[model samples]
Target: MIRINAIPLIASRTFLPRLPRTVRQYTSYNVAVAGLTESQEEFRNVVHDFAQKEIAPRAEEIDKTNHLPEDIFPKLGEMGLLGVTVPEKWGGLGLGYLEHTIAMEELSRASASIALSYGAHSNLMVNQLNRWGTDDQKSEYLPKLLSGEHIGSLAMSEPNAGSDVVSMRTKAELKGGKWILNGSKCWITNAPVSSTFLIYAKSDTSVAPSKGMTAFLVERGFKGFEVGEKLDKFGMRGSPTAELFFDNVEIPEENVLGQVGKGASVLMSGLDLERLVLSGGPLGIMQAALNLTLDYTHERKQFGKKIGTFQLIQGKLADVYTKLSASRSYVYAVARACDAGKVSRQDCAGAILYSSDRAVEVAMEAQQCLGGNGYINDYPAGRLLRDSRLYTVGAGTQEIRRMLIGRGFNELATAEDIRAYNDATINGGVRGLFYGIGLSLPTHYILNSRVTAYRNLPSPAKAFGFVMLIVPCMTITAEKSGEAFTRSQYEGVAKRELDKEAQIEHERWQSLSSVQKLGDWARRHKYGLVGASWVGSLGVAWALVNRNKHQTTSQKVVQARMWAQGLTVGLLMASALLTGFDSSKTEDPRTPHEDHTWRAILESDPHLNEEERKRLHEIKRAVVDRKEQLVKEASNSVSK
Candidate 1:
């Protein structure tokens, strides 16, 4: 005698309910076609269970005590997660990027602060050594990290050099045969508890700091290696952060990580992986936020009825879903590139940028829906909100991402810039320009102007740069479209994708529009201002470079080489700006409400699907059958 058709039934048919499957699909599995292997899945289950049972129960207590993840380093090491990419010969799992990213994303979902501590220990610090360290260094250090015998910490940030990396002041002087390092590293995670450190210092005081920088492997037991006072932080309390003081630490030439003048190279090369891990860790955090918010909205009732039934709440829920899904898709695109052996600095930067930015957005929405209760620290959302704040500012600020993006404008049409606006910067005709507008500008008007300018023709080298400029268009495609890349768009058996996109667009816009448009006039005020600036910068750069008239065939070939280099620089910068933004704010404000509401239950508890669920049930039955039989063996063994 029960009927569930209870709410706004008549009006339901007027609105599309199911989300567009393309966005839905991309949102869920952003990594690419490869799902987890059975073993990988088992690893996921064990880790998930461990997190839920151990970490979740104590998360509040641990967070309150500012319990750093140092004590937990041994546990993650035991789980074979740290050496995800190192060769097993060096005591590592040698797993690919997908698996590593998955582990980061999943564990972080429970408590991002803990995940950060553990991830930095196992991933950023250890993996960097594995990738670039000499055989002696690996033999000496990798095993310690893998066995959890030694905790590795990175000492990159200083009192200065947070974003401007080249302006470091730590000095390392060469003393006859041994190098004496004398400086202090600040804001170092795992510093107080760390047994090993990857320290970057300037070897030659006179040369450019970034260029003369050298990397050294320092151990806690070293004579001059001492831990200073621990630095208290707002989030990531699950990891011990401290100032590391080094006073005339004598390190032999043997301890050098790479070549003397190659510290910058080592740090830069390792940074790509660091960014990848950092980006991957937040995927799980967002997923958890979604699940928690879903539970609260559904369970909490108002006015003698489930509040979730109200259109206003449902609209909020829908918006949360769409934003999370879009961010996931963006993360997955970057993951795909990284997993496919495309772990360039640009690729990782893009991944970090997109994931971090999305994380802030999703986390904020979760906080908002919790209403007054969302502000309370007792709830995970409160902690997540505080924890997520550091993403944009810690590694690189959003402003830095934007500025870096500015460098790539010569290539990526997706970025907006000031120069693109006619008299925008000078005459104050417009403030900013965006790329989507430039690309979508009326073709006749835009191209006619370009064609008129094209009359000058320029030189072969400059003309080739034009081709490089068009290459980013090659990246445009549906988030989940399965197609070979074209120079400017997608091409393949994409009939299904094309059809799904229309339905997807309608739903996506609907969900996004529900959040109340701030002001349409403000949005329409400038179109593609950033992109226009990018185009203008490229134009100016082309003008400044002297045109070479050398018509030799070899010289023509050299220009081709130049084009490739130019493409790489622009693409990497574009990817960084477009893909690598971590947060929308330098510091995001969050307040947890004192009370909250919830729906009965949630999704992304990461339960098995129907078939898998059935299989799990069957396995449980089989385990029960074996339990009684196993008691006899236990008794016999005990008797023996």
Candidate 2:
């Protein structure tokens, strides 16, 4: 007997499609993108408070005066934010890339311009300098760059070299113990105010300036140095940018950054961070825009009704949510990869390339939602819109970033690479979790939060934080039961015969830590994530109508959808518990891998060639198998 009920799915259809757009988007990615670490979260709160109190309050005035954010950096220095990614021993926070990006998100909410100011120091110049600078140079410069006392800036683009570094004309020639530097760099951020600059200049006769480029630490008092005319822009006025003239300035012999010719690494890698940071800048802006638009639409009324009542406005809000949420997850994933150490240049380029393009789309949409108010200076969306244009321009243009990202993908992706890539994923899945979550505070907290959020979810719209909880719950229960039943269905002799081939020595058995098993199982059934969010949202809504009077009909509809979603999610969890190869025997509650019960067969295992390729096939098989079994089980359970 097949039991099919159209009633809940019907209600889901009504409610899930109508959720407040931004709310749904954010909820979808809470776990996928992850969030700030406990330490970083504290820093984020500190930054938020600081931004609100110091920067947000003064943003209007700063924009009006087109002033440089010279005053803000002192406090940022005092707070240890400017050097968050700089090594701690070197007079900086040493929090790393993810934390640094999180800080950017919070600070930029106050002022895109000010955020860029901090970015110019850490992302553009300081990090590169740390990687490429000489020992003497590091001891002398790192402390200052990390300190608020010495500002770091990059002088690479000239009037002619905006997106084309190969076209740079600035030249430096050997002159005994000094290198004679000539030509000028334009659009240099923190110019005039910045104390130190990573000045890139052509050093050889290689015809192509890019191949001959050399990076030098040109100090503020360098001879024959000047800040050119300060130019005004459409937005982000609080941070200043200008041209830097190098009129045959002399760099000391020891000032050679990285063996004179290795400047390409300095340029590409530093710019990768620049673009990544640039890509991340808009997360805050988009989030702020979402918050602002939500407040504005809900507060403002037309025809004696809130504008939020109209489907048109809801539609606009949904678009903003979708774009921002998608972009945020992608950025976080990429940023986390970089933070994990040695992110490929191609990966970094790909992420930022996608990020900036999305920023433009979302920011513009947010502006549209504000209507006439969005155009006026009184509202923030308009300013953010103009300010965000630099995201597409700075750190390299969107067009060029696309070219770089595309070229990278062209090289990395191929049919021959598929098996190797798959194996890597499998290996990374178990071990990556061990290392990434084992040491990472943010990743640990994020998963914990997702589980907590799932447990606390009472309605559809609010219950959307994590998708991992569901698939594993259902898949494990069904798979284990089926296998057990299949084993039971055979007669004693048949079952005994079957067990031999399928099973090996207990000592040979490899098991996943409960968390790893859950993650692996969940990854297999990832498609259920979209199903739960969309369908579950509707279930929660409808469940609300039948179950709770406090909620409006629409809200109730959403609750019903969520309730349905909760079932699927819970089932996946059960599935994981039942079918995992190794039973969890740990008593530690702090984290899943506490006693190291999880073991994966990677290079040592004969079953899998490569971790990535093995995991890909395993995941595909498990998930598809789970789905087919789930439908049958759901039918049987309902019929009974």
Best by lDDT: 2
lDDT of 2 by residue, 1-640 (tens): 2111211222113422344454324332353145644455566678778887788767767887888766677778888887777777777787777777878887887788888888998778888877787779989888767767888898888888777777788888998879999998888888858899998888896656556778888898988998887779788788788888888899997888887866776887787777676666887777767776676566556777878789999998898788777777777777877774546666677666666666667778777876765666666777788777887777777788778867875653456555554554455445534443344445445655777864465655333422344434444544554444435434544776557635643223445666665555554555576366546655554645576655455444434544555565455445434544333452322223312222221212233334654454455345446555655655554455
- Error in Å for residue 400 of model 1: 2.0
Over 4 Å off in model 1, which ranges? 1-43, 69-71, 411-640
lDDT of 2 at 192: 59
**Root-mean-square deviation per candidate:** 26.6, 26.6
Off by over 4 Å in 2: 1-37, 206-210, 412-640
lDDT of 2 at 553: 59
The whole-model C-alpha lDDT of candidate 1 against the native structure comes to 0.64
Question: With candidate 2 superimposed using the best TM-score fit, by how many Å does residue 71's alpha carbon deviate from the native?
Answer: 1.9
Distance from true position, residue 538, model 1, in Å? 63
lDDT of 1 at 615: 46
